[model samples]
Target: MKITSTKLIAATVLAMFFVNNSAKAQSLPESKLKFGIGLDGILPVGNLTNTANFGLGLTPRLQYGVSENVAVTFTTGIYHFFTKEIRIPSGLPGQYNTMENKLDLIPVKAGVKSFVSSNVYFSGEIGVALQVDNGGGGSQFIASPGVGYAGDKWDLGVRYENLSKTGSNSAGFIGLRLAYGFGL
Candidate 1:
């Protein structure tokens, strides 16, 4: 089933409220710097689904705790999308030719992570995604909002990311990230 943005936001808020109310409160890491690397899997949505079957990403992030329950983050990543084969009708009857297409992107973002409970957090980011392919496509603006579980050394998150450019349709995906973090 397709998830609408309103539903996603409502779900996240409900989860945060329940977790915060039911779980024992714990302190967030304060005044500390941490680094993490994440492996991401994405399912193409919206216009992206037309061309890409799936995507994989490698992202590295740096976080600095600014308060008891808030952190500022910088993240960069490379994402590659595996595309479906496109079939074109050949001159011969009942014959077709297939061509493969792929897309590569580099994203740079800055965001904030806010802990609601001890181990659950909400995050949001805004950035630019630069398309690096033979087509020489330009950059697009990106926005992502997510919710996650963060333990001492591991984190798992789910997010919706949208990329858009002027005069063009938007593209997006629902993504999951698994990461390992360490204090720096």
Candidate 2:
């Protein structure tokens, strides 16, 4: 039931992302590379045991535009965090600990985006991610549909990503990237 709801929400967001196309095309500079950073806060929606300590996170990414509608990205950093209050039943005094509880994943995704109208786009990408904790193995498939405006020097976007992956449970990290893309 949760999976079904998640899929439905993803589909609706994608539909909104593709709803218009008549805006002007903002030209990019000679360089195709763009850089961006974002703040992300998420609760474990489909897989998890706790939502009590799912703190906010951040992801920074860089992308190179292949054309107006296609791009590839490399993200060198991501963080998962938590804060837990521990109580000792026997020995140690009770304490509150804020554990950023970080495990970083560096991912490179080669993907494409298509503008449904001038300001809305749909994107899909697949890539390998190296789990920075325990040397475990994992990979990801992220498909996002977004709406954005290309400012004179940057692109501002809001997107919903259906991020599927392996090993997040053991890795002590969240399973996805919900982000904003900036054209560098």
Candidate 3:
């Protein structure tokens, strides 16, 4: 019989790799279908000045499992913001009316969620947003990053989103969400 140091080292590394992977596999959730809805409250920043101040919105999501701990998500949401109001001449003489400032955003995105632990996860999304207001409407690119705790039937998370407009400026906000889902 013979024993070598290099062989022993290689064997140890291989064993450790398998043990780590098995532990991760054990913590992964089973694949299934899930649906959830959430709400977001945001404060505008950067290029969104004058056009947006504060916002509140709703998000509805559908997720389909691809692996034990991985899922593909389809999401859409809308946010409303009150910006700056301007005074305009009313139809009657010597009368001025204040125009209300409101901006609405609708985003549709496809994303992937990966569970890193039994109850912890991270996700990223890229999509397009339809921006509408009293003046005119346009579309822009949107990106989002999120992290949260997920359970068997519910989850809570926080996300930061960036909406890039055609011009030089961009709009962004941070939001919190609580969602519930069921397996099928």
Candidate 4:
């Protein structure tokens, strides 16, 4: 009898926890989807050993609530990276006025969102980052993550992107995103 009572109590607690989690799953302040535009700073890390130069980019995003705390977002944008220094195996640095690796990326992602309070929410997206160009170039695969806040008229975001798909293909891409959203 004691064992059964303990199991019942545990089940009740677990059910309550799931109910609470299901309620706190979104960041939007209203009932509609949001459309946003923001600035981006995409930079490569540890590439030019002694180089402090970084890349600049821009992003436009669409966010919809699959649930209160889970959102599906699709982002498409351009990334420009300038390299004043790049470390070589020769133990020296090379300079490039413009790196041809700059690209246009369309990231299709689904993110889990948790509303910290009323107006602010933390979110993360893990999805396919597809690369394409206007010059009839090729495409590659990337992984992306983002965190943002919802405002009265807009949403602000910071994102990390990974595109260097070599070996295990684990490279890190970090950037900032600022956007404004409207309902559908």
Candidate 5:
């Protein structure tokens, strides 16, 4: 995976969001509604790394607290990857053409987060990833599992994501997320 300067800068900015919002974690307030923004570093692994390179993206989310320890969230994000062009030979001899690959991934998902401790939580989300510029397939199912810390108004988490078709190729990656929440 290529760790470009842009990716590092983005990751740093996202981390700052958490730090800035967490300035006063001495008291954790209870809120019924919260909004969050986050950044993710997408490292393609397993079969996914074979075709695509690393990616970076942003996620903005909204959550409604169902109880003191549980919340339901609606999330969406865009992840961009780098891929090489594909060359296909025409029927004519000595003729070849290239196809473009737009490695943009957009995922719209909804899930639940369960807080096991005051500062620790586990979450799962399911949705479809829309593959922009994919000729053969335009969409694939995605499932993500995340674990992280939660504060009165901020959070930090690590997540694993899977994107795939039932009988086709699959992609996996690990991502880090930092988010800030506001009480309703």
Candidate 6:
């Protein structure tokens, strides 16, 4: 059976909601602020895999608890995608030359995190990603959904991030983030 993207996303959200409802309730600090820095490893997917081999990112985030199990967040980050070498035809039959390409992006986002358990949470974010290149690149809209484990001082999460631009194909990646966090 073929599963569409919309269906998959809906299923994931539904599953997370069920998990949250079934898990034993835990208390979270209210009206408290926390800061975190995360290092990410990304694997290109969809059309992005055609050009990029892998990616790395650094992100800093701030979270403010609004309720016992919910928090609002702001995140900004830099991501660099390493591109594969491509061969270009050299104006002659059976002759070619290779060139390398790369991409850098900076993202600004706002999101919400809802705890499912004492250490598990589900998060969703939406924002814009600005491209950085010699050609003066443009920006794309970004949306990401993730699930994570947050401990006293360490957090780990996995997310699927999608970026869309006008007049171009959308790109995506699966990312894993390891973070260190503290109260502020």
| Predicted structure with the largest TM-score when compared to the true one | 6
Q: Which digits, one per residue and each the tens of the lDDT, describe model 3 over residues 1-184?
A: 5433234334433443342232243122456677888777777766676666778888888888777666788899888876777678998999999977678878899987766666666667779988766655788887777777777767788877778777667667776778777655
**CA-lDDT, candidates in order:** 0.84, 0.48, 0.71, 0.54, 0.72, 0.84
* Alpha-carbon runs more than 4 Å astray in model 5: 1-31, 84-100, 134-137
Residue-level lDDT of model 4, residues 6-120, one tens digit each, is 3433443344335346344344533567777767766665432133357666667777666555466666666655645333354446643433343455555555554544445
CA lDDT of 4 in candidate 3?
37
Q: Give one digit per residue, the lDDT tens place, for model 6 in 1-184.
A: 8544455556556755566555444333789899999999999989999999999999999988887777888999899999899899999999999988868999899987778888788888789999886574789998888889988788899988888899998888998999999999
Inter-residue clash pairs, candidate 3 = none
In model 5, which residue pairs have backbone atoms overlapping below 3 Å? none
TM-score of each: 0.84, 0.52, 0.73, 0.61, 0.72, 0.89
Cα TM-score of candidate 6: 0.89
Model 2 root mean square deviation, Cα atoms: 6.1
The collision pairs in model 2 are 20-117, 21-117, 21-118, 34-184
Model 3: residue 20 alpha-carbon error in angstroms: 9.1
lDDT of 1 by residue, 18-110 (tens): 544444432336788999999999999999999999999999999988777778889998999999998999999999999888689999999
Candidate 5 lDDT score at position 179: 74
Q: Any idea what lDDT model 1 has?
A: 0.84
User: TM-score of predicted model 1?
Assistant: 0.84
Candidate topping lDDT? 1
TM-score of 4: 0.61
Candidate 3 global TM-score: 0.73
